[model samples]
Target: MLFFTVFELVAALPYSYSEDLARTVAQLGALAHCSPEVISAWSCPLCKKLPLTNPQPFGLPDFNLSGYTGTMGTRLFLLFRGTEPESVINWIEDLTFEMVAYPHCEGCRVHAGFFASFKALRGQYFDRVQQAVSAGKEVVVGGRSMGAALAVFAVLDLARTFPEHVRVSYNMGCPRLGNQQFADWASKQLQIYRLVHWNDIVPHLPPRTLNYRHISREVFYDEPMANFSLCNDSG
Candidate 1:
């Protein structure tokens, strides 16, 4: 009975259908080649200038939850790094297919490998995110690929605890994170802009056969002429 009630609540969520090409490119670049030193220089369609200079950067020191925070017009951009080819071990290990119930939200499931990586930074980094919100900054969590998947879980947890503080989540080439119910619930809580490049295979990972579904609001960019379009949740 309770599960049915939750399903009803999630199914009522609406999907945003729009495309922002500039943001798609910028975020993809940041995911590939960004650091604390030059994060402010990263521009997007939403904010011409991120203004993240001298942001407070933190991570688990030995984990992938590494990120930074600073004001972008009263909003804080918390961006994570994707699986780097140089980090061969992390990249290879995170390909596992075990799906598990995410403890932070009811009816939410996530890749077990990504969730384990998230746990390493959950305590300290999560506190820092809370502090950033307490300082009156809206949070926008984002990433690409594996980092994008991590950001999905992080944003869901943040929305569950500090819904008012969470502004949105922007991910590029994000892999499938959870079930349809999880995607529906998350779309209701925050605006999730998932950007995909032409033939970018990362977003199709884990396969729908495993019950993996991407969150809604996808922006697709086709190369050569650089055409862009928006699609529904299934895209």
Candidate 2:
């Protein structure tokens, strides 16, 4: 078992939000949910010309992740798929509320199920990400739902190694993955754009009463394709 002691909070610099970038990232995240064939054939206007390579699907029989690693100009990207509607395992992972010690950081704990899913694909994803960093490219990670949680974990782990290269993470409908200690530690390590779409219940899950908390800089959209507000971390 792992345990942690309180660490002083370090104020993170505010991240500059760009709607265009967010839309592009969101497209990549959605593309992650597609089948391998679809992903290969994908011809979206936003990323059609970008050279996306190293496409692979990873996970166990019970848990799976569909994503790809690619680069556009100077930016390297790792995008992950969200929960599949018919995946019982995915829902099971989502509902498993137990908190386990996150060994990578002292006093950091994360949702057990989310961590499990992440572990299944961590090695493969890390290897590719490491290669990209070695090639001197800035990294951007993004995902939706459970994939978002996994992205958060990847960002933290990546930050441990290539702190300068692990640029930022863009997550949509992300649930709170860890306790305050983890959130505090993560906030200072990297810039995270947690996008919450108008009262989406997933972001509110495993409830704060259970000691789960979110990281800083939440981007909240109140209406469909309407204006968005940058929320304070307190929520």
Candidate 3:
């Protein structure tokens, strides 16, 4: 069940698949590539649960060769979400290293975000992803909602550095990050993808101003709630 495979089954999918749509496709691609579903059904690939905590710095346990398609390439993935797991010290440190200790430039402010300095932190993560790519590893990133934002950033960052390495990227219910400049810039920079389900708006509070910059590309599950959010839900 390649993403296109599932996508075709669902809908023709209007555009060429950008940003959040790319991520959604990747998730399904992984599922399809991993195995042929005897029949279509709703299930969790991570049904066992990774049991990870916020900023805990733990790799997905069963991600490696748990029956995925591929001829065996070294796999390197980075998944770190924001503080929802109750234990988020590791995330704090990673950010501290990138923002506080790094160069004083390159950090964009969405508001309180400027309270910290996030220099080449963006490039650093890009480098990490690049390293995996250089080693001939298939790199994939995932995060809940807040983590999804970072996952999106990771794609943008990697696109800047590795270019070809970032074949696909995914984020689930991610919040808007950076600014209009950042999003507009990134929309063109990377093959970033996002996935939002109906009104499970964990990736909430975008368009800080009362004036909403309609996100026509944001991928929401084709459902009543999603339709409502896209319609009368009106920014």
How does each model score on TM-score?
A: 0.75, 0.84, 0.51
Which lDDT value does model 1 have at 177? 78
Top-TM-score structure, candidate number: 2
Worst 10 residues of 2 by lDDT: 1-10
How many pairs in model 2 have backbone atoms within 3 A of each other, for residues 3 or more apart or on separate chains, i.e. clashes? 1
Model 3 has an lDDT value of 0.40
Model 1 CA deviation exceeding 4 Å by range: 1-50, 85-94, 104-107
CA shift at 208, candidate 2, in angstroms?
1.3
Give the per-residue lDDT digits (tens) of candidate 2, residues 1-235.
0011232223335456656567667877767766676666656654474456555554444456657776776778888788875673567554868999999789999899888778787876788788888999888888888888989888877888998898688888889999999888888887888888786778887799999999877877765536566665744
Once superposed on the true structure, which residue ranges of model 3 sit more than 4 Å away at CA? 1-5, 9-75, 82-128, 210-216, 222-235
Alpha carbon deviation, residue 230, candidate 1 (Å):
1.9
Number of clashes in every candidate structure? 0, 1, 7
By TM-score: ranked, best first: 2, 1, 3
Order candidates by lDDT, high to low: 2, 1, 3
State the lDDT of candidate 3 residue by residue for 138-169, as single tens digits: 66555544455555555555555566655455
Per-model lDDT = 0.65, 0.75, 0.40
Candidate 1 lDDT, 100-154, residue by residue in tens:
8876568878788778876765664677778778988887777777777777778
